[model samples]
Target: MAHSAFNRKESRGAHQRLDEGCTERDDVNFLKHTLAFYNPEGAPHLEYSDVKITKSAPAKRVYGGEATAQDKQNKEKANADDMKHVKMEVMRYNPETDDAPHFVTYDVPYDEQTSLLDALGYIKDNLAPDLSYRWSCRMAICGSCGMMVNRVPKLACKTFMRDYPNGVRIEALGNFPVERDLVVDMTHFIESLEAIKPYILGNDRKPSEGPNKQTPAQMAKYHQFSGCINCGLCYAACPQFGLNPEFIGPAAITLAQRYNTDSRDHGAKERMPQLNSENGVWSCTFVGYCSEVCPKHVDPAAAIQQGKAASAQDFVIAMLKPR
Candidate 1:
């Protein structure tokens, strides 16, 4: 995997090569699945197979800043007067009043740029004032509006209404008990995060001792994992977490790796107990869905895999040492 990544001379998605500035997709030579045959004694044999383009042709995706003021005003005006409406079947539950969770549909006037969060806001303000959900910072940064949209975990602020113009179903994040309408009890997830010791540990140095600095190379090692916003979307997408709630799960493990990989941190040994346990990195099946749903692209699956390798090496070294 490392060889293939290093050989690829382009910047695309999460894989960026410093030697090669962002280059156009090489569809002719590189649009294929690479198959590596392992050799225990020597370098692996590499082969490539043609990728079957199923739905659409590959194209360059451009990410831009927010819409201009005039554009926003035009869109808002169009949405307010537009007769077109989208049906939103939101999951409703009130433990204090309801026996079980139920779905309530609402028709929301929307424009091409209206997001799921916007529709929910309209429903709250207009149709159903009693409706309950969590949201803040209508942008994706807050990570408070995570929910299951059409059975797929997504940030409500990031999902556009146009993507599901016909209609859409919204529910609380999966792999968690519902606390109320579109709100899940996050106690377990938070506990798991705490178990990994998300912060720097055993740093006894004081301000008088001087600052702890890190090089760009050292920062690059764990920078990707540090982008996690604790949205819990990775937990929702993790089938392992769904099956066994005891598993440490993806985000927490990734956060552990973030600190473990920091050159300035000495917490790897302290955190090894959790990372080497039965419910640790060994529990992951590498489904990779966690990475798919991650808004920050933290790639928790890769972090867990790296943790497994480190744990295995540690076990061998421990076994070889005399008591």
Candidate 2:
């Protein structure tokens, strides 16, 4: 797997190759699964299999264009005719009224371009005013509207209703206690984030001691991990956190890795105790689901795995040097 990844000289998704420096997707050579056969004595044999493209064909994205009035009307009418009403099963709970959480169905008027957040807003405005869910900024930046949509962790604002034309089940994020309808308790997540100390701890340098400047190379080391918005979608998708709530799940660990990699940060030693703990990098089984579900593409799985290697090296060095 390592060999295959190294040889793939194209940038795609979260995998960016500095040597290649190409942003365009290379569909011809890499749009397929790479199967590696293990060998005890020799280099592993590699094979490629075609990816099954079921629903839509691959196409380049065209940005910045508004649909014409006629096009908008046509699409709206088509959507209304095709899907008059969409049955949304939203999880509802209230400590005052209900003892247990239950799914409350709502038949909402479907629109083609409308997002899942929009549908929820419609229900809140017209149908059920008492229904509770956390949302702010309506954009994907806030990361507050993250929920289990069709059993996958995604931002409701980013997920369009047209994608799931049939229907979709909405619930609170997994691996968390439900505070109320579609609102999971984020106390644990917040605490974990705080423990990581997700800030630049410079070398005791004050603001008066000139600027803590960094070159492009220094920034690139931790830039990707810094994009995390603390959505907790990674926690929802992490099996390790599900099995052990005490585990310092993906996002926090990723943030730790982020700061550790930064050239300006000097708090890696302080954070090492948590990273090398039993409930830290060691607990992660590397399911890679955390990376798959991250809207920001923070790639927490990669960060944890890298932390494991670094921690192991540090442990071996400490043992040898009696430090």
Candidate 3:
């Protein structure tokens, strides 16, 4: 990679060292790419692939390229009085090219409305085209942009850049495999959610039957727990989940409690067996960080604590019953 890049003779992006003077893009000679072929017991061989251009003639890019022009514009605009600067340290990784994750700092322009997601977008658009991350529903409702800013789990959309006076160091959410950059593999979290049967179960009643109404007191029992958006922030916040990926996790356990406490849901008896398992609610030590990081005030830690009490009482009742 070093040899290939050094051979470019250009003074920008990958071609860091320029023994030759800077010049506009010369597509005539530079249109081809270098390819390396590995050999078993000898030095690798180099080959070149010519790029075929069938369209209109290529335009000469002065002072780097269009990327450099846009970057210069952004930098100049950032110098205005109303604009402010936010230093963003974003973690980057690519399984194909990178051996491990590494942090890359970017100076971004921000105002009162700029968020962590916005900073990332600016970096991707104007600075680095290869930057990878996840985001949707710019509002916090979609829960797709969860990440760790300064070692604390948060939703990038909801977290404003102005709050971090010093700067923000962003990484992928904890306790999950990095899919790419800020994106994580939430398959385990999805499986855990599915294991608890998140939906109302065995409700085969016909529409003719009256509504299974619940009083306000009954609604209050599970209302707070029902607020979970399945953002996985609680799972990231949980130290136990970090240690054991096999654990059902805070969001799933809290979901179990949500349905178990609901007057409409009759799946509690079915859910208890899973909750009583080795990788169930008992894994939680009530660290309460799950509740602290919950974007919707789901309070998963409280639900898990309640589940422990329920588990104990169920055990006692089962032991005393005449069998």
TM-score of each: 0.74, 0.73, 0.74
User: In candidate 3, what are the lDDT values of residues 1-323, reduced to their tens digit?
Assistant: 22555434432333332445535555555666775555665665666767787978789766544566656666656653467887889999998989999999988888788888888877887789988888889888888999998999999999999898688899999999998899999999999999999988867767789777789999999999888888899989899998988999998998999989887777888999889999998888888999999999888888999999999988899999999
Candidate 3 collision pairs:
none
- Measured with C-alpha atoms, the lDDT of residue 106 in candidate 3 is 89
Best by lDDT: 1
Residue-level error in angstroms, candidate 1, position 15 = 73
What does the lDDT read for residue 172 in candidate 3? 97
Q: List where candidate 3 sits over 4 angstroms from the true fold.
A: 1-82
* Runs in model 1 lying further than 4 Å from the true structure: 1-79
Q: Tens-digit lDDT track for model 1 on 1-323? A: 33555344332333444456636555655566665555676675666777677897689664566556567557655757865788899999999999999999988888777889989988886678888888899888988999999999999999999888789999999999999999999898999899988888877889997888889999999999999989999999999999999998998899999999988788889889999999999999999999999998789989999999999998999999999
Better of 1 and 3 by lDDT: 1
True-vs-predicted CA distance for residue 177, candidate 2, Å:
0.2
Error of 2 at 179 (Å): 1.1
Candidate 2 Cα misplacement greater than 4 A, ranges? 1-83
What's the TM for model 1?
A: 0.74
Local distance difference test, each candidate: 0.86, 0.85, 0.84
Question: Whole-model lDDT for model 1 versus the true structure?
Answer: 0.86
Please say which candidate is ahead in TM-score: 2 or 3.
3
User: Candidate 2: what lDDT?
Assistant: 0.85
